[model samples]
Target: MKLRGKTCLVTGANSGIGKITAIELAKQKARVVMLCRNEEKAEKARQEIYKVSGNTDIHIILCDLSSQQQIHDAADEYRRRFTSLDILINNAGIIAGNERLETADGFELTFAVNHLAPFTLTLLLLDLLRHSEAGRIITVSSEAHRFARFDMEDLQLKHHPYSGLNAYCISKLCNIWFTRQLAALTSRSKLSVNCLHPGFVASNFGNSASAAFKALLILSQPFAISNEKGAATTLYLAGSEAPEHISGHYFKDKKIKKPSKAALNDAYAEELWEKSAALTRLELHKVSLS
Candidate 1:
């Protein structure tokens, strides 16, 4: 599919799969908007994308996904600058340290950045996306979700023992649940939403991990795929025509794959949607995709 006239927004576009995805989209002449946290890093990545793709339409909007206020501001800024959105990629995530951390909104740090931020941002931009001819929402989940122990009562992991690996796993599980619920909500529309496992690219994704996790990452570096290879599935979902009408599914290696039984629980998915809505203070009754 041609992306020349498409408008795509990618989060965490300053590095890793996000940066590669942005660069590839720009190469196809898409009007790309990169939402990043660091101005310096974003500018550097923007320049690199421009130099590589020779597409000067790249724009950057700095947003720290950990803060709900910042996410709101960024969404507003995006609306002010753009009229419609064809593709929205929620690709930013982090593995917090062993010590539990909380965001400004008082939510667990891992959950806030990996799940809530994208959940809130997507809802804010739903109208714009629905306005497009064909809208797609691609979230980068992980296979690590298979090990997640989801506690609906303690979604924030407040009562459970906190560990970086566990927190990261749960957050990824939320990503799949979010994608499924969102796809169901937009099924009657032209929008398509899906999540994927990006094959553990050797990047700085583990920089904020705990000492043990960081060491594990270091040990696995030689076996991990390169950033370019890791981004293949994301770019496939973004640019290919194969998945235009496919929604509420998981992908790995650019093909549909069955997620864990937990991810397939419709009841759990609906509950998660409600919980996320409450956390984001979003009035679900007012949200209309049709």
Candidate 2:
């Protein structure tokens, strides 16, 4: 898909893989929307993309993904401003410190930002996406999803040991589950949804992490790929031809990879969708899967 006239929104575009993805999309002449938590950082990144891509149509909106209210307001504001959306990239995420934290909404921090934020925002923008000729929803999941196993009894991980790594992995699994379910719902519509694992890049990913982990990330930076290299798969899924035809799949290195069995379970996906809808107070639309 040529992105010359497309409008694309990218979350967490202030730095890391998201920034590079937005810049490349802008280079393709797509009107880029950078949704970030910090206005100052987002403005700087927006200026950088505008200068490098020579596309002055780049825009920025402040959105703290960790808060449900902020995401809802941002999505509504975006709808009020833009008539249609061609692409939505749900790339914002957090790997909290070793100690578990909760968002203002009382849900676990990792789960709220990494998974629920995308879930709420995408559903809110479904109509605008349906209005477009080709609509794509690309979420940034992680290979760490393999470490997650669905536990209906303890969905919040309150009963289990509360390690940040476990929460992060579970949230990644939620991303894949959400993608599969959304793709199923929009199968006959113009919208297509998919998720990917951008490889470990040398970026500021763990700034909020524990000191030991931050040190480890710094030490591993020399071996990690550049942010631009890490964002290759995202750009492919967003701007390449016929990505809509390949929806409901997990990708890495621009190639489809099998996710965990839990990620592909139809029942689990549906359950997750229902739970997410309830948490976000989002009205669920009936999807004619027949």
Candidate 3:
């Protein structure tokens, strides 16, 4: 597809699947905006995307997805730069290792970086996105969500014991929940919100885990797909003509697939939407297109 006139933002684009996705989008001639924490690494990734796609319109804005203030500032900067946004790939995420670290915003690392940040950024940029003929919000959730239904009661992983796998699963589940809620909010509009799992990709996730867990991840990763291969489903959902009419669903291999029972529950979706509004302190009245 030709995204010649579109402006796209891909978070966590300094490396891994996010980088690959950015390169693929740039090949289609979309003006790319990279939201990354590290300027040195992001600058390198910008150069790489230019070389790979032979498109030099890539722009990098430094913002740590882990920090709420930075996310807001980045959104403001982006709004000032672009008249409208066509595509938003909430691809920035983290898989915390054994030790739990808190973000500058006082949130658990995995939860804040993976789920809260994207949700906040998406909500912050809604007006600009709604201005487009067709705006797409693609959330890269995971199959790990099957095991981790969002326990709103234990959102901060307080009551529940923290295992790396469990925390990651909860974050992924939140991603899908947010996507479905967004789909409902944007229904009958110019926006389409969706989520998908990229399958198991051999990436830095293993390296981010603890030593023994990293060993296990690496061992299992041998059977996993490469990042380029893992990018296929997301690229299809993001750039393909087929998904234009599709929204609020999960896909794999370009086909709509069944998500978990919890994923399809409207009650859960509503609960999540309300809770997220409270958690992120979003003023929905200003954003409501209804």
Best by lDDT: 1
**Ranking 1 against 2 by lDDT, winner:** 1
Q: Please provide the root mean square deviation of candidate 2 (C-alpha atoms, Å).
A: 1.7
Total clashing residue pairs per candidate? 0, 0, 0
Per-residue lDDT, model 1, residue 70, is: 95
lDDT of 1 by residue, 143-248 (tens): 9999998688997899998887899999999999999999998999998899999997997899999999999999999899999998889899989655578999
lDDT score of model 3? 0.83
lDDT per prediction?
0.92, 0.87, 0.83
Poorly placed runs, candidate 2 (over 4 Å): 286-290
Model 3 vs truth, CA RMSD: 1.5
Strongest candidate by TM-score: 1
Query: For model 1, which pairs clash?
Result: none
Residue range 16-135, candidate 2, lDDT tens digits = 999999999999999999999998999999999989999999988899988989988998889788888999999988888878788899998988999999998888777777777878
Cα lDDT tens digits, model 3, 155-259, are 667666777667888888888888888888778787878888888888776567777777787779779899898778778877856547577888776678788
Rank order (by lDDT, best first): 1, 2, 3
TM-scores of the candidates are 0.98, 0.95, 0.95
